[model samples]
Target: MLVPLYNHTVETPAAFFLVGIPGLQSSYLWLAISLSAMYTIALLGNTLIVTVIYLDSTLQEPMYCFLCVLAAVDLVMASSVVPKMVSIFSSGHSSISFNACFTQMYFVHTTTAVETGLLLAMAFDRYVAICKPLHYQRILTPQVMLGMIVAIVSRAFISMTPLSWMLTHLPFCGSNVVLHSYCEHMAVAKLACADSMPSSLYSLIASSIIVGSDVAFIAASYNLILKAVFGLSSKNARWKALSTCGSHVGVMALFYLPGLVSIYIAWLGQDMVPLHIQVLLADMYLIIPPTLNPIIYGLRTKQIRERIWGLLTCCLLDHFSQNS
Candidate 1:
């Protein structure tokens, strides 16, 4: 039997210690505060988006239906990682049991994959609305929208299951310390005593293929949308069409840019990027998009904005009437 590091005789660690960020121990308090605020914003914003869409019958179109799915995904994605990360940052160190760690890893990756699918769906939604306006309703009926949602959720869970299973099979006779705040797949896989090359390569390839394919489809969608928009004879009509896509584009950039950076940096090895920087990028990639998505949509989408504003006005009026 091989002796383990850290004076352990077991082949696998019982729990993993999460260090919030390498070399940033002294800033844990500040980091915790910032992360907590972002998590709070993400929770409230996404919840509000879901509630608003649900309450307003007028907002039951395909686009708003897809927006509700995106908000739900954001809620799950942020919730899976942020609370534990906040705990780690606040305590300076946190230990998660092996099962719990793997569970978190599964949720994080699964939700991420689902969100990617949702973004692609939204892009397709836009493409149809812009390119096939006359047939938009016929093409994206309630039944079809439901089917798409089911497909997205099913594909995400199926694709991410193998990755989690592969990680759980690896021997962890070495260190039990995970160098990041959250239990990321690569970060946890690196702690295994066994040769983790297969896991790493699988992760890199799977992530690249999934993200790359979705991005290509989304790009192609926008390309056709822009072409159709520009082909409109009236400047106002072109502007109107492009404006509808602005929020989706902003949300996409916020999600994919930092995510791509984090993915590639992990693939390139920690030598090129500082470990702390990599961790921060990973954190921001998950946190920032959820925090800003609702805000972007609320500001850019007229119907959602009007519904939100109307709700606020009603609440304020009720409060004043009661007080007076």
Candidate 2:
């Protein structure tokens, strides 16, 4: 486990990561444990999605290709933040170095931006598939998919880089206790010993750019997709369209709604909740989406369901063959 590199005096977690305040009890530990379990499930879930997609030759279409990217982003997003959370909860020490905290903040939000872009791409892919099936191949070719990934990653980092730099430039004269599981933007900004007005402004702008723009594109793409899908007069065509859009819609709602809520909380100065509750709810940002996303895809997509069972069967047979 990676331990904190810097200390404020002694090495005990204060305020955010651990429930180590004067009156807190064992229930907090249980909550952390539950979150750890959730992270494990997220890891497995995203891994399974990646594995199935990579292994199945038939899943080489743009939809699954975008889903593979989504799964990979979820994998990183969950992994980048979770181990630190587990460590802080288990050891009751949440001290992180300035550089390390900035790095964490960058990667977590970077993955988030990547996720938003991929979701938009997915919405666009669905539009092509349903609205212009004949042109789908030309529209979303492999080279085009690669360009999309590069663009998503590049644009995300470009938009958020200033916010990452803002963390380092701010002076932390005294306060070091972050008010959440990991080094999130709001928590880290609140920890600044100096006034965080500049950092706060930068974060707001970056969020509006990366998160805000991605969401706008996603909503717009889906709006057009809705019109096209509904234009299909046949019931069977309607069902197919519904089925195709269901997973993307569910995943988008799962990710963005809570994220928007968190922005609200951060804006409201965490809204008078105990730091513990805030931390728990904040931790939900990492937990819920990754675990549920694969399940959402599996439930909505016949190919994914079949692929999962096929993988399960392959694993069982491999185990039996190895044993025999």
Candidate 3:
């Protein structure tokens, strides 16, 4: 039994749900319509985040600054998932050409990796503001922030490039079907006929390079944050600092938990993720964070709440004046 199990190869793979649709329970109709709505909301939601932070000079600080970077990462990640989903649902076929699949895989991983690093950056930003206020300006200057980001992004691109290249070299002689939706490294790697041990090792390395480094940095940042927040002289200042970092904390948890789960299910669990569930979770990372992050942050921030109220009041006044 062990021998057969060890020697077995997966031949036929098919995802249960159609892509780019909403309401996963039923047929493609609802899923397509739902995903369409999600994409629209993700686009508008993250765009508003970027625009609000950009348009308002008051929000140009390090906290909101990191948010702008988050919004950008969300946009890239959303673009990778939403369009392909729409294509599959609208067309009734999940047919991604080889090049397109790899391209999508590359960017999807890139944004996620970028987000992981960016979250650490934000955490460090908070630690500085609370822990070392004296050196905050010197530590997180415009040139410094920009330079750090450039280095992180370039590093992510360089590190993940080998995984994609390694994957491209692998031969897919058997099932072209990717078990779960999208060309996930694990999902696609399962199809490779050659020795994907290197690819698998690379996957472990990639996970460590991205998640491991980010987690370590984030842990260090938060440790300093806890120490600093506890030392705050003012009660209100402590609360304010905590509130500023809350959305980031939430975003980090949401992004990382599922990611850790996915890596487990893909490499260790080995096809245990029911196709439908995997699709839902796959899209959740893309759809949920982008839509919810702004709302969470806006509701939490006094400035954002006041701005939203003011915008609504202006719209109502405009409508009444026009009609009257």
Candidate 4:
């Protein structure tokens, strides 16, 4: 543990190699193409969401502001990993510098933590809007929304900094080849020659604390929402209320379910699970949510759907006029 202070002189590799889907090494070209497509879609979708929200004054509500934050986070998160993943798959040049690896780890965790906070904030926004409509505006004022964003980012930074520091301080004397497409916490931790117990425990505890609490809060908020929806005498009102929450529920499920499954597979199926399967699950955990989030929101939320249609129509009309 204390070896980090003196280990600079030790023969540690300056960079670590990312072994992306060891079994698919023969078809990395095809895999790269597929992943590139997904990355492109994610980038386009999230970018469109952010841009539409910004340009459409009607979407300047607290709910859409939180959504913009989510899309931005998703963009950063996808950007942080997918480009490197593409490079590794296409060129087979998977070497990432030690400093760079830690940086990736930091950003991945930080973005994930921040996204969770944003989801919770979204839940709160929904709760206020649906349950206490009168005070919704009062509760989620501009200052409060700004403060929530600041708090979300700040909390993620404060929480994940120590994990990165711990990883940096660990002495790595083992093979520098990481067996995944990205720099995951446990994957990197397990590479250290030092006792990785503390790192493992910290990762588990931190994830459990943050994820658990966010899930609980979101669940509680939804419970209240459900109660409010059911309490209404009108069946149409109930359906409308449920419809408003459908996209959020879909997003929350998309974000968490695969994540939980990936964590279990990574932890429990380390030896039994095929490397490709684990890699796929892990990649899905990261990419799927970002890729689908915008689509779900745009399709399920009437306001966003109409706004997107209007924007697309405007673009097409402009394009035709310019050509004419």
Candidate 5:
């Protein structure tokens, strides 16, 4: 048995063992390979998005600015969990120090909230560009954009702070084994010797409020945007406006659907869904979105696509010239 961080007098364990997926120990090799592949793609894709946007002056609009933030959030979200998860599956070294686990938990939750906020911001950007074209620049000026990003990050930190705080206060005795991949809030809380209802309830409520409200606002923005698009007399204009939003809408669906499913399974579907499926969904929720966001944007958004193609062409030419 693993040694406890403190003697019987203590409440928390020194390290927690993470079981990647319960009852699937035999599949650890394949699981590790899959996660490692997806994580590599996520790192490369999001990094390229951020780099292209930063280097290309023509892409320095509000939409691209928010895309850069979204890429950055995707990077943070994937980095927070995937490396340790891959290690757990590949090496059977599932032990995570108490501080490291909480830190991972904080980054995972905070980046999730920040991503939701960014989606809302992007939706608003689309709405302004489509609905109030004349004021797009004025409405989302450098000052306003900066303020929005700062507020989104700050709000996430403030809201998610309680999750870790509540977990810390609870008395964790006995088993330090976390059933899910990483140190998820509810997973760790359930190990506490004391009643964990409050922590669970708080997490559910906070997630609901943050995701629910942001989604509602995003819906409202798109609703107005649609109305404005239809009002346009030119068919080409309508298509152009919608094409701009297609990537954002796709990204939102990719993010919110899996996230909601994971939350539901964690909070309510314990008896309905198998434990392994629930853990898989939770892992995919973090993995899939980050892996796909850049692909969706790079292919759907014309400017980004052209810029990426140019960059690739330059690299290929440089490599051939060096060989010659």
Candidate 6:
């Protein structure tokens, strides 16, 4: 009786239920409004970034090219996961098909990996621009930049395929409810009846290779950048060089630190951390970076800020004209 019941349970859960927050049933309205605001901001900000970069031919440099890549990736990342999450929170319907869950997991992981790679590319661009100003153009030619984008996207897709395949094959004999709003690889894996050690190990290895190594390379690039900046004879030159990298560095820290912490707690201290805290951190790991990235990059870079100001002023003038 027990064996049959176990088999039936494992095979029966065709869909998984997603609970956005475990103890927040009474506050779904507030949560939905907050999440909707975040999602809207992320979408609008990234879209504006892409549009500004495209419209202003002066911003056609490699840095802006990579910025476009980052914005596009953030757009996809937010779109892939947030709408479903908002719907779940708003309507109180949490059921997601197993196949849909895996699809979401794949896009989330792939876009994240692509963002990590794009960050590394941006770091290298800065390194070349600052450290080897004479050779920057030759090093990051249009052809080369295109190749890097292709490689970054391809690598992300290939790396996640095996992990997603493994996840799809897992038999989820336990409860079909996922505790978080989105389908994280580890979150979903935890619900499987089979031993998920292999999946976890693979995830660790992939993350190390994609995220960890990119971080290491980014740090090295920044170190070289600092050394070069300090070597400049003029203080203004030094300040300008440092200022150029400030936004990228801030974005990197915002994205990686929370991510590392979330990964740590998810794997090691899942029981130690409170469920609410874990859920918040998990959501922030994805949402905060995309939401803040546009603001940080936009305000810090003069070209983007000027374009944004121009656009905003034009809109205001148009509104006033219509009202009058």
Candidate 1 vs candidate 2: the TM-score winner is 1
- Summing lDDT over every window of 10 consecutive residues in candidate 3, give the lowest-scoring window: 1-10
Error of 3 at 257 (Å): 0.8
Q: Cα-based RMSD of the predictions, in order?
A: 3.8, 4.1, 6.7, 3.0, 3.3, 4.4
- Taking the tens digit of each residue's C-alpha lDDT, what string does model 6 give over 1-324? 001123444455768899887877788888888878988999999998999999888998899999988999999988888888788879978888877888888888899999999989988998998889999888999999999999999999889888887777777776988988888778888988888888888988888778889999999999999998999999998888777677668778878877777777888857788886777777776887788878876556888989988988999999999999
**Of 1 and 4, which scores higher on TM-score?**
1
Task: Give one digit per residue, the lDDT tens place, for model 1 in 1-324.
Answer: 112233245457688999888999899889889989988999988898898999999999988999998899899989988888888878654998888888888888888888898889988998998899999999999999999999989988888877777777777887989988889878888887777788788888888888899999999999999999899999998888777677668778878887888888888888998999988888887898889888876546888988888888998999999999
**Least accurate stretch of 10 residues (summed lDDT) in model 5?**
1-10
- Tens digits of per-residue lDDT, candidate 2, 218-269, equal 7888888888878888989878777767766876777887676676567677
lDDT of 3 by residue, 1-324 (tens): 001112234332222232332335356666677778877887877777777777778877777777788887888898887777776766767877666677788888788888787878877887787788899988999888888789779977988888887887766666676655566777777777778889878877788767987898898888788778878899998887777666667776787877777776666664586656655666677667776666775446677667556666887999999999
User: Could you arrange the candidates by lDDT from highest to lowest?
Assistant: 5, 1, 4, 6, 2, 3
- lDDT string for model 5 (1-324, tens) is 112233457656678999989989999999999999999999988998898999999998988999999999999999999999999899989999988887888888999999999989988988898778899888999999999999999999899987777776666777989999998887887788888888789899999999999999999999899899889899998898777666667778878887788787788848888888878877877888899888876556889988888988999999999999
Global lDDT of model 4:
0.85
**What 10-residue stretch in candidate 4 is worst by lDDT?**
1-10
TM-score of each: 0.90, 0.85, 0.80, 0.89, 0.90, 0.88
Question: Clashes in candidate 6: how many?
Answer: 0
Give the Cα error of residue 292 in candidate 4, in Å.
1.0
Least well predicted 10-residue stretch by lDDT in candidate 2: 13-22
Which pairs of residues clash in candidate 4, taking residues 3 or more apart in a chain or in different chains? none
TM-score, candidate number 4: 0.89
TM-score of 6: 0.88
Error of 1 at 57 (Å): 1.9
Error (Å) of candidate 1 at residue 285 is 1.6
Which model scores highest in lDDT? Answer: 5
- The reply for model 5, stretches above 4 Å from the true place, is 1-8, 232-247, 316-324
Q: Residue 263 of model 2: what lDDT?
A: 64
Error of 2 at 36 (Å): 2.9
